[model samples]
Target chain A: MEAALTAGIGTPLSRSAADALNSVDLTALTPGTPAFVGAVERVLTSFFTTRREIVDPLGPVFVDAAEALAQFVVRGGKRTRPGFAWTGWLGAGGDPAGPDAAAVLTACSALELVQACALVHDDIIDSSRTRRGFPTVHIDFEDRHRAAHWPGDGAAYGSAVAILIGDLALAWADDLVHEAGLDPAALARFAPVWARMRTEVLGGQLLDINGEAGGDESVEAALRINRYKTAAYTIERPLHLGAALAGADDDLVAALRVYGTDVGIAFQLRDDLLGVFGDPAVTGKPSGDDLREGKRTVLIAEGLRRADPESAALIRTGLGTDLSDADVDRLRTVLKDLGAVDDVEGRIRDLTHSGLNAIAVSTTTGPAKKLLYDMALAATRRTA
Target chain B: MEAALTAGIGTPLSRSAADALNSVDLTALTPGTPAFVGAVERVLTSFFTTRREIVDPLGPVFVDAAEALAQFVVRGGKRTRPGFAWTGWLGAGGDPAGPDAAAVLTACSALELVQACALVHDDIIDSSRTRRGFPTVHIDFEDRHRAAHWPGDGAAYGSAVAILIGDLALAWADDLVHEAGLDPAALARFAPVWARMRTEVLGGQLLDINGEAGGDESVEAALRINRYKTAAYTIERPLHLGAALAGADDDLVAALRVYGTDVGIAFQLRDDLLGVFGDPAVTGKPSGDDLREGKRTVLIAEGLRRADPESAALIRTGLGTDLSDADVDRLRTVLKDLGAVDDVEGRIRDLTHSGLNAIAVSTTTGPAKKLLYDMALAATRRTA
Candidate 1:
């Protein structure tokens, strides 16, 4: 009924349904959209608090892990996965004031745990020393080992602790959903999507690792990894899960899929671009960190494809190797002059527009569409 | 009704319940009991088969991980965790012929995955070269890297893959329970126990790792780690989960907990004994591997506590270092002279008796109680 009135095609909506639409800013994106994402930080704190209470009695060292996991999660993240999920829920005609809202929030917040696991383990795999401008999980543990003068190789001990902590976060993520008080039917609907999300993200990550290690430079492989590694978890599954929670039908779900896929890919594209070009002060990471870590992103594939022979050789030499600031600047100039950055910018614009149009055709309220518009912009045009 | 007849102090069981009791051989333990364990092999196979089907299309390299996980799970394990879970369900009045029986099996079978996660990551953390007389997961991956000449430190590469594989196995174990088709009410009862089990096991594993790294050899700490690390996960939680699935009331659950904790700790004590005294051909792992690994078992704690000063110095020297055959023999003599070996064996017998007595007094039927008795014996007296 709300959709009918909003589309200007049928009888007026009931007062409650119309009130739901009127309760928030519909004409423009409310700045409070990020509030939902921020709310997850508190949920993480509570989760760890309760977990510490339970496991500390088992052992004080367990308490240490609880603290580490909580610190890692609450320390930083845009909570973008949960944000996408919230947007998807709103877009699927679910009212934020509805009975299942808190359950939805709890379920969505579990994404942070999944992301924590990925980042913690990813840092170890990459041998990355820093994340969010701080020592990554393994490195943090390593530093603790060094500080205490612990036995065994400090690096290996740190990695072991990080591995166990990552494992705990993943397990707790599963528990978060189950303990969220979703009815059996909702849980049944949620399980397969959640399971698939986990498998695909892991698969995508493995693909990324293998591509870099195996030196596979194919654009197709890079794009595939992009789709699964970031897109699937960041946007696709979150949308699917939210829409499913809102009891979305086939057409609405299908529409959200198209929107989420394009937008998510664009989001990752912007991240890749930022990795090379953004200032350290702005991005909280050293510029050209990707060049050093050798992320096999679509942008890199494009640069390799379009660069002149000399530039191509330089790109190859600099990829996955230590890069001085001067080397980063040289690669930046190549990316710009060879038209890779321009090409990627154009692709991002196209993907974001395609995603926005998909949202437009869906039967969600106008306000939901407007919020999604802002999300797509926030994801794609942040640096620009 | 079956419980009444089993204790021989009340009315006889109904024909079907009595028939259920008579269906399996209970006297002297049927050899077909291992068949229950062998069933977990198929579950792991099917788990990988379906997991591969879902992930392989997204990335073929994921198939490699699935293969590795399946190999690790199937290659070797006593399947003892699942066995204990099955026994718990049986002893809690859950009929094997009932509708929920298959679901119980599926849920219990998931324990194999948890154990797989532990073993895989434990091998990496311990830097163990072999498990079950075969290369461990990290070692196997390292060998693959060396064979392929992959572009990274083979050790780091191996650890990375093993970590990811272990993470996947942990996630899938959660999925196994969620997808097991337990009704909502059943899930509510089961979730807390499952969650606690995962947390405690990880906690226990962390504590174990920390103790070795910190080199604190206190007997109390060793026993605490033994309880949380192996006893709680291997015996207590499995029984608790099984009993909860059968809708066992608090009293019965408490009874099972007592029985499981005793039996489980005894199980680990026997393992420690076997690690030092058993033949490599029987245990599959090298004899005295724990001493080399600096495991800090209760027996070691006792030896360290009770050995004469010169013997203690010799024992400390032999701990956590490469041991020649003569060194191993000397450490063995220290353990024997200090009465640690005899003390541990005596504790195993007493704990096993306590566990068997707890099971005997429970309201489970005659055949179930008989099976429990044999299980305690098999777990504690399995040298042959």
Candidate 2:
């Protein structure tokens, strides 16, 4: 025990291991965009591989949970947060070849784990059965329990285990940042962004649940939830955190935030649209999931506000219930007829335009400004 | 948003606020014993006060949840983890009046929030109705949902909100430590301990649920669960974290771990005893709650191993069932008749003695050795 303590436990990713995971010739591509996504993915893989080793001794069940998390992290999502963070770094003149590059990259990669933590817990909260076309973590565990004929309520067991797994992801997220090898001064600047991001996301989650319970249907209420729950966590803080890690000036950080907030809100509005109307094959979720889950999105809120009495009743009845395809189509048609869909699309366009305008006016350097402009469009226009 | 960002959000504990909260002349009392508890509590109050302010603008519902968490943190528990952490610092020759004293105290205090997080999540996992004689976080939220006629499954809503609250507590725990003002080197050392502590606890929790679901009643399995679940998180890691914060020598840390491991196990063994036979009023839980939860304790494992076939049948039948007092008493008689209770008591005595013996041989400085000796006995001998 003493020897292990002295030697330090949970060794960082070895150079060879990192190289094998990241065979891409990162130097050949542009930094902080396509190249940055691969870099972040490699770090996530390396970090999870090391974590899996640590949990390996705990036995197979523990290993199973850790592996599920690793797979979820390595294969899931579009790396949206880390992409923004990297672009933010680039915008702030952070050199990908600088001495602090590894640390910066590691810290940026940690965002995915935070996202993993959020989605895992959110699945449990929503009682979501699947994500990315795979069973949700809790559902996975619940199935494991049922197959084993475990001596408990399988759903409860699944939820309990998922909760802990989410907790582990959150813990390891901080660990990754701590082990990122940032100098103290850089770390000092980074800590508050990290803290605030966590608070806002968690707080936003609480607000979401609270609003659901209170049955608040106002558009302002929905947008407020989106600001903290999605915008701050998904974009604003990630970009701010990256700039902070680069020791960016206040002006740069603020300018990037303005763009992040607008784009983030627009991104979520796009998600709201996708949740109700996108192809399940592309979105990797059942169509009308937001409706089934009764998600209080800006689109829904606007529809409820703008619809006539009969249309409003139809929208309200279709929401938060097990909806058939026909029911979903009816709701969709009503939303279109009432101009709710157009209203939301207009907002998305306006928000995206405003976000691009912010980037256009900023003193962002090099290719980053162009990337930022492109990303705003891409993020809002995505199918999934 | 820019102005708020520039001014710095979530301000630290102000001096006047700290003074008002901690009116105790901490200098007059011993640094690491009774006095340390109050210091940690004071820091917690200040931290929560500041945190509440940050969440205040999120609206009343967010503030209400945050307040519940703040109350749980400030008023709950015996502060056992922080007590050991403070003692660990003292044993490592940390100066009570040193320039880093405030930072040390704040970091030590953060352990309580970690405990709050674990307990909050644990209650939801266990589906326990009450904790410390108060409705558990989930139950409180469930009641809130019911009272408000909230649309949704009240229990699910409660669990979801509690999960967010716990996550918030966890995120804030890290924030407190990060904002504690540790130097780069001290923070670097502190990082791994914090990381490992979280992993061990969460992993231990997984192991525990896995054990219960699998019905692995072997004493070895039970003890293994105890080793990681309660012992490491409650004692060993807290001490290790404090020692690391003080940059203690490896020898001293190893020695303290030895004592911590032994005492921590003994402490858990005592808890197992209390969970069954102790006064419900004193334990702040229902009588035979552990039996109802079907917790695989060393005592229960031993009883199953040692009992006759009919007695074993009795034990198995009673283990996880909802038992009347008569049934509980019958099970208690069978456990005692099997000598399991005696076996556990003897183990507690021997472990406590071994832990005290380690303290006697260690190079731990000042009054810490004596305090550790007393704490080992108190921890293992208490009824609750």
Candidate 3:
């Protein structure tokens, strides 16, 4: 299953290239990948530490709020977006070994905070009780309220706290970027892309939420939503941001967009398949969450496209349903029988190749190109 | 009641200065004042407009979400925070006539966004049904969901929308600043204050929320909350931000803080009194909203302090209750009878004078200093 595709690279590998050649996993092999995320985690710790200093003068309760957000940011996340950003910077001929690299890394770090905000709020929107295999922020706060025997609806209180924390994370992400002391001209150049990413991500999310309420059933419509929600924020925009930081010209940025887009769509396709059919132990989510949420993914759209009328109706019922595990299994078979599963897998393979080819034709350094190519495989082919 | 305190300054007011001198009402006068707020309002409109352009490319439903945030930003708020920020820039010996003035104004405009985020989420925390004379964002969304024949809990959907919008506002505030092309040095100088304001406001909000849940009832505790939530973010940080933009010395920053603290606390204390006593038409809120929300203001703490056991019990009963009009009126009498109203009034007067005196001792220019003095009166003494 670890289909280390570097097994087929034609060129001889260097020391850094060896890591790219050695594994297809984004999580374990990338140098300072752990350190990059760890740095962000440490920054998160210090953010709360500094906040507690200010808030301590106010009250312990305020510290409690800051700590909760800090924990949320530091604890979860795969740092996938930031990893792409860093690679995009490196690929755009930016010196990873330069002093500006730290600033760029810090800028990359901001994405994690944005991701954290998205996740917390997404959970609230979906009424998801868990994330990363733990109680979600809203549920955690609800439990705190209930435990404290606070007046008012525990759910309401939980939602309020979650809202504030999400807002705080959004604010802090900006704070982190400005604090990086990046070149002003570079920052000015980067603002539009950064602003676009933030708004597009939110827009994408709104579309997803709207779709869950039963808007479009077409695969084209579903893919459009996925393009904005998953592709832009998760990969394309991040790569664009890093490219901007690296002083990338329009042509290079355009090339990365092509690479990021195709790769990004494939990434979400894999996630959608996993949501229904992947093991909970591998996915770190309860099995069939997409089915429970009635996610209108392209895979689901395709399934409905091919199903018989009665079968399609039964498939529709699974959207946002509280079905038994066996019922979910039965629906899984219906999707497989309709050829939706096979269709998605085929599309993912084609998309991944196009994405890898985008990077290959671009004027990126060989090592960074290998990394991006590896990242694409690792992202779309992961079990978890 | 209009205590026109253009006290004995030797010079005749310029046309612009005349407007500043003519009225102590912040909502009404000064050159760029109405025009300044108007400018910020327009900028806010364009922010969502641009977002709509991006989001529209995604889907009509996302455009719906963007439009809601834009309208909320445009249709409401006094632009009070930006007002203070712009004045602070002028007050710190920064030339209003300089080329960089527009940048300062743009920087000042960011405060309104922070304010919007805080207000939306605050309403959620307080379960406030209306703000600025309309259904709060959550309630508006809830009504829309109910009307649209959408499935699931309308309130939850509404809350989810409100949360996302608030988070967007927070993110956009940062975007606005970076997009303004402020000097890197000045931006760096301003970053800490901006960061501090966001976090402190959140901490303050948590304290206010915590207090309403029966955590604190003393005047000291309430004032502490006020210092963070209202005073710091409202006046002090705005002034500090403006002063930073102007490259003001630390002494000037500290001086503005003193003024902002006194004026800000006075501002909120007046609001507490008005929650029970002000005219709804003037206040632009449902009469007694804060009272209904059971906000733990210093005024309430004062009432609880001097109240007889029966009166205190009556006041306690009003905290977080679904009180009828008759009940609100009765509790209003308890505050008045206990001399809590008068006590708060006295504090307001003392604080306003202290604020004015703080500005007088600072190294601010005359016209801008005059503006700050007038603003203090305008903020604390307004009916709304």
Candidate 4:
């Protein structure tokens, strides 16, 4: 089963991954745009630099934590979240060269900081040791503590420092957005979305934790978590906020939200698949890590319901345990045999198709629409 | 030395404590200024109620923490901080019943939340089990975990839950202030001060943790921490912000700051003395709890500096241990023998006198000045 499926799908997935990357014309951005990008970059850099300066006076402990946070943020990712915000502003017939663009970017930059805080704290909670192919903040600090012969358990010290750093990052994110100097009315409009995003993310975290504690792992429960935890915050809220800041009308904002919600869920579903099947070299994580972590994904729940009794027992026993290569292979085969993987993939295609349909009807077009389309496809179609 | 102090003082401290409480017209506040007082109370109640509603969806773990926080906040304290802010606003000729008043109280309410988060986190960091005669949040959660037979160490679970709760509170504090509906110009002016206040408090915490860890025990270092940690945040910034929002002239803001700084430091010094020597029944805690917890206070540093070599070594060794009642007695004797308690009392008197003098020379006198004067004396002279 493994040889047949791998041979059938491997080449097409690779081509799709390459095609998605190729669609984003990184070089097509005008030279004039970098000035705006540079301004946003400068503000973000200054925001974090000032943060480091402020925390530096606190002590070496605070300094170390703040430095780690700054480093983690500055180390490049796709910057897709901020880019979505910037492009959304431009798509609403707003000038990217104006102060509004800088303001939007500044707010967008704060999203990254917020993301860093969430990721750090999430890693601590999940007991994850690595992120983006590097040791997590807690692990990094723990290693330092061990090297320095600290008086306490190195892991505990690392966790404590990571918590404090996350707190500081959250505070700084708010401060940066406040100081972005946007129109008062616009900022007022954006405030609730920002506030709700934080609340939903935290609420989603609570839901995730509760599910892992062996309470109701129903489809409705997982979908609720996905909506609040990932979909709304990661995509819908950011687009709405960007649009709101540009004085976008309700219809446009509503359209973007529909588009965002579909893309967000599709993105997460794709991530679940990759977590189980993608190569470690490409994903920067071990294959089958989500299964080992016993993540309460829709895929797993579907698989559990559809599998034969003997197979279901095997999965229940093996779900959270560290699995050998052969064990992972067997679990993957069972999941495929139960048709859970195909079912999830089909759902992803439905969401993507719906998202594209929404985009076609959207009043917004040109570069912003193009970028959003590319992003939506890239988010859902990735192998990693 | 204890016998000598009892013989010399003749219970003057007890009388001063009673006189301080009697002097404040807290009851007269309701009848004379019902609208103003009502506004402040309404704002605080709504803030906490809204917070509880928002956190309710985060599930039982978060709901438990939120309820505990709401309960702690609703059991109101002196309301001196909000009173100072209102007095400052009114003293600067701002209407007490206007939007500015609500803004001031909103900001003041946030200060209380900030204080709650700090106290909760501080208890976790210090491993203390009680606050304000109630089981601390961490301890309360730990007890709940143990009772429910939850997985993991009860203490770790308690700390984890408390950390998240504190994060939520801090995030809510920023949201409340940002959404306080102040004028744009006023918000722009207030932003830097608000940012600085948070940074300073964190900075002060760092100084304190370091000083305790390093065993510095220096009077200057402890006072520096008090200035940033308590003095600036507690009094100076709140008053100045209220004044700034009201568009007070720089001269008036400067004058209020001078008065606030002195009173703020005096307030903390009084708290330190109460923690070490105040009557347990009156203060609602065990006597000499700070001594048992080995808080690195100015009084302790002064005692060590002035004590004989043998006594100094004993004091240094005793600094961070849970001392017995008899040991606390001996520690008090050592402090009194070195005249450290008397020195602190003298410093408190000087600060109170200076604060009153600042208020007297300023042209800002009115009901606000009278309120500040009463607050200064009460803060410096209180036993609890």
Model 3 is docked with a DockQ of: 0.26
What is the DockQ for all candidates, taken in turn? Answer: 0.28, 0.53, 0.26, 0.12
| lDDT by residue for model 2 (A235-306), tens | 888888888888787777778887888889999999999998999999878888888877778998899899
TM-score of each: 0.89, 0.93, 0.88, 0.85
Model 1 lDDT, residue B190, Cα: 81
lDDT of 1 by residue, B265-383 (tens): 89899988888888899877778877876668999999889978898898877888999878888889889989999889898888888777766777865766776677777778877
Best by TM-score: 2
Runs with alpha carbons beyond 4 Å of true place in candidate 3: A1-36, A284-287, B1-33, B279-290, B322-330
Residue A251 displacement (Å), model 2: 1.0
Off by over 4 Å in 2: A1-35, A52-54, A277-289, A322-329, B1-35, B279-289, B324-326
For each prediction in turn, the share of the native Cα contacts (below 8 Å between chains A and B) that it retains comes to: 0.58, 0.56, 0.49, 0.14
How many clashing pairs in candidate 3? 2
Docking tier of model 2: it is: medium
lDDT of each: 0.76, 0.81, 0.76, 0.69
Q: What DockQ does candidate 4 have relative to the true complex?
A: 0.12
Tens-digit per-residue lDDT, A288-379, candidate 3: 98898777889999998998999999998767879889989999999999999999999999989887887788887777798898889888
Rank list by DockQ: 2, 1, 3, 4
Please estimate how well model 1 matches the true structure, expressed as its whole-model Cα lDDT.
0.76
